[model samples]
Target: MVEAMAKAKLWTSPGGKRPDATLYAAILSDMRKGKGARFKKPAPGRFMGA
Candidate 1:
């Protein structure tokens, strides 16, 4: 998950190895956006496009 996002250049700032966790936090935040979310977790430690 993080590998794909990192390769896609998801985060512009806070660059480097920080994506290991910051990415998940950012992704989880979107999940709380209700119907406008950017991602969804069908299972633990797993993420897919919403």
Candidate 2:
């Protein structure tokens, strides 16, 4: 997913991590997952936000 997802300066800013795969491995790396996840994907191709 790292090589797949586009890397941008915003991800690097504020001392962010490298590669997008890492985030996915950690239940979205502290973003979204399932069952008590921080986010909810109600609609297709849309994030409800944090």
Candidate 3:
């Protein structure tokens, strides 16, 4: 995730392409594969700050 975030800084969206969409697709894939997206749900009234 850190690597992707770093790479994002160097990415440029040409022709109105959405780079974030691609990143999200990869995240969903990882979630489906039981990888990085196994985070527990945040408690009520407790925000998960970025």
- lDDT on C-alpha atoms for all candidate structures: 0.80, 0.45, 0.46
Error of 2 at 16 (Å): 12
Q: What lDDT score goes with residue 10 in model 3?
A: 39
Q: Model 3: which ten-residue window has the lowest total lDDT?
A: 41-50
> With candidate 3 superimposed using the best TM-score fit, by how many Å does residue 48's alpha carbon deviate from the native?
8.8
Query: RMSD of model 1, in Å?
Result: 2.3
Query: Which sections of candidate 3 miss by over 4 Å?
Result: 1-4, 7-16, 35-50
Which is the winner by lDDT between candidate 1 and candidate 3?
A: 1
Query: What is the C-alpha lDDT profile of model 1 across 10-47, one tens digit per residue?
Result: 65437757666787788899999999998899999998
lDDT-superior candidate, 1 or 2:
1
Model 1 C-alpha lDDT versus the unseen true structure: 0.80
Error of 2 at 38 (Å): 0.5
Best of the candidates, TM-score:
1
Which candidate would rank higher by TM-score, 1 or 3? 1
TM-score of each: 0.72, 0.29, 0.40
Model 3: per-residue Cα lDDT over 1-50, one tens digit each: 43456567833333236666664454455456543453322564332222
